[model samples]
Target chain A: MKRVLAVTAFTFRELIRSRLLFVWLISVIVLCGLDFLLSILSFGSTLQIFMDLGLAGMEISGLLVLLLGLAVTYTTEMDQKAIFLHLAKPLTRGEYLLGRILGFFLVNCLVVLGMGLVIVGLVVFLGGGTVPVLFYECVVFILLEMFVLTTLGLTYQMIATSMVGVVLYTFFTVFLGQCIGEVQWLLNQQLSHWVKVLLRVVYYILPNLEAFNLKDRLYDPNLVLGWAQWQDILLYAFSYSFVVFLIGWINLEKREFR
Target chain B: MERTAVVTDSPCAIQIRGLSKTYKTGFWFTPKVTHALKTVQLDVYENQAFGLMGLNGAGKTTLIKLVLGLLRPTAGSVAVLGGNISQRGVRQRIGYLPELPYFSKQHTGRELLGYFGSLHGLAGSALQHRVDEILDLVRMRSAAGLKVSGYSKGMLQRIGIGQALIGKPRLLICDEPMSGLDPVGYKEMRDIFIDLKKAGTTLFLNTHILDEVERVCDRVGILHEGVLKEVVPISKILESSVPVDYWIDVDGAEAAKLSGMPFQETVRNNGGVQVSGLVLAETLALLTARKAQVKGVRPLSSQVEAYFLKAIGAQAHLNRPIGGRRP
Candidate 1:
């Protein structure tokens, strides 16, 4: 436990100092800047503009966090041989993997939260009123979703060194996971019974990341989320993150330092 | 009451028996297993500076990795501090300094030590104390707060030693610890090893620096072709082992002519002829009988290298033929 905390602290400090963090923050600010400039044209309703701009910013920032997190982790330790110093001590592979995943997760969460706040501020200023309560709830879901994706991305980085592997795996887990249920239903309608069963199995195997995403629900009052649904999604996201970290831990355990 | 000095006989710091490691790589589905380490065994005592010498591709790094539990040996057992290295908690008592030390680019020397100290279960005031002590020991205290990215190669090496010493481990394993350092850096590392030994820390050092091995190590082991060929005390290697030629400054030409002694190899000189394999006592006896002025005798080791070469060549010749390969 002590080793975990020590490694986590060091990992967090490393994340903060990396150029990836600065680049991620600047990209979010740039998106917000472009959104503000677009809002001046009076193209749509204030809420419509705010929601569209905010969701886009959130998605882009999440992507930046994922790619940067993967790149920074894959190359830094390897190119520097810094991993040896840590492994040389009493630190276990499990503790080091956990520390890395949690550290990156926290950084991504903080970046997303900061962007969410900026979006809320822009909405209040444009609408000329206070931000809606649903915005806060949506922020929570967004935080949970980012946590899940970041953990999975970190696991991919540990298992595979290629950036392409991380990007491709993360894409399928996030975007394809959202469309899996629809794809399953479509496959059932078009294919034979056995193929439908296989497709359903495939759908169930994916992360179902769309379940935790509640951003669009903020504007649709009829699709309101109850506390039970929120709890379910939260539990699912946390468990998925835990499983990803477990895989990462096992992967690191089997790795030879050479 | 004063504690009784109970001497418990523990196994050597590292013991590997019949260890083997094979790495598979090929284009086909069926790969070829390259034998990186083959049936290698080594035992290093505590408080001894054991040097592992080998050329490239000799499995030196692989052996060290197995000892550190970084690599799983395909066969045999590795027991470190009386515990299986594959199991957890065995690493707490061992400190390793790798060949080329690297750090998290953002961490300063102090943070690196603190992290490693905490990893070894040191926390709070004790952890802080250890960090400070190690930093000062490696002479890195002044630059303790600078990020590691800005550190020079020598400074990085010093900080690497600091991290290894943070736990005050009973066993300190250093792999090529002086690889890229200048002469001064190398000397400083040697000094640190001496200090660690004084503190009763067992150091296992692996390097190709023959001179450094002679200066620091107590025992030296040579690794070749994934196997340990020889392990001898430093004293034996440093001393003249085989018969060496001696240069004796003696008296007159008449005295040299009078000497009908059997010198294995001889050369004529102005007064006294130079002879090979002449012991000091024999020379003194001859000089004393002749009542001639005798000077000092010097034993040369240049012939020792030739002897080693001949021995190695003879072994090679026995393996194959002079120019033909064994079918």
Candidate 2:
């Protein structure tokens, strides 16, 4: 556990020094600019628009940091062979992968939470409105979603041979993952047997990102925040992450540095 | 020539038998197979510096990786520290420095050392003390706080060696440790290796620099084209009567006497004759009997270099004439 944390801290320091937080700064400016413009143009409540845009900005910022971090680390650790020293140590390959996942997740957390605090501050101070309780729950859900994506991204890093390949694989997976609701809708419609089988395989394979997406239904009067829903989402997130982590660990163990 | 194992009393730090690595690349139907390492045998004893000498593509790096468990062998086994390298305890006792070591640019030298030390299970004040000691040993104390991105090549090599030693490993394996160092840095690194050897650290150095091998290594292995040609002690190579090239300086006034002489090659410009060690006496006698004034005689290559060339069957490729006949 100490060795894992050591790698985690080392990786975090590396990303921070690489100036990854600059993405958060740009995100805050854009989020505020978009919030103001959309609120002025829309006829709905201004606070609703503000909070909705803020949540979106947080997710987008987290994703940008993940993709960019993957590229940067792949160049140093893979292309430059910096991982030789780490693997040469007494640490196991699983520990290294876990540490890297935690490190990437930590950076993503900072970016997401930093943007969340900014939105909360604007709503309470400038708009003179109380923030909804669902906003906090949505933030937690976003963190869970980030954790799942972090595991998948690092798994792709292990399986990929090039930096571009890692980025593209994670990018397409995120896109398809977000379309789970539509795939479900397509399933309900009449379809060929073979096509339905393919859809079923993909649906079970890609992460059900729509499960953690509660921001869109923030104002729904029928929405219920219950213990059962939380349990299901949490279990799905962890189990999926564990499976992906195992795949990554196996790849790392079998990899040859030559 | 077949490889003759060195007879040593010390236990082997690394033991290899029938080890080979074959890489398969390209498409599946038409794969390209490269025999990087053949079925070779070697033993690196403890508490001694062993040098593996080879030309480019001679499988030196392949052999090192095989011993370290970085690459899975296609055939055979390697025992490091009397145990498998895959074991954590064995790895904890080993240290490795790659050729032209590269580290993440975002870390300071001190931070990097501390991190590696922690991986070796050192923590708290012990880790800090070890990091400090290594920094001082590598002569990078002043630059320890600076980021690695701002370091020079020599500074990087120092930190590389520092990390390798932070674990206090019993076996130190290095690939081209002297590469990219200035003369001063080279001497400092050599001094460090000598100190490590004195402190009871087994050194396995893979290098093309013959001088470094002669100065530091106790026994040397010559590898060529994926074959272990020979393993001999430095003292044996030094004492062997291997023929080396020599240059005899003569008086420029005797330039006329140099023509048509039975010497290898005569330099009329400097009134010098280059000859092999085999005919040095005969050539000097002829010069004396002819009343050609002899000024000085010097060897152009070291005995180790000549022996290495001869072991690889590359003597014919030497530029000097053989048996007093011009190539």
Best by DockQ: 2
Best by lDDT: 2
Alpha-carbon deviation at A95 in model 1, angstroms: 1.6
Model 1's TM-score against the true structure? 0.83
Q: For this target, which candidate reaches the highest TM-score against the unseen true structure?
A: 2
Off by over 4 Å in 2: B1-7, B251-257, B265-268, B320-327
Fraction of native A-B contacts kept, per candidate: 0.82, 0.75
lDDT of 2 by residue, A1-258 (tens): 999999999999999889677866876798788987897788969889989988988888888899999999999999998998898888889999999999999988888888899899999998899898899999999999999999999999988999999999999999999999999999998999999999999999999999989999888888889999999999999999999999999999899989
- lDDT (10s digit) by residue, model 1, range B133-192: 888788888999999989998898898888888887898999899987888888888888
Clashes of each: 0, 0
Give the least accurate 10-residue stretch of model 1 chain A, judged by summed lDDT.
A42-51
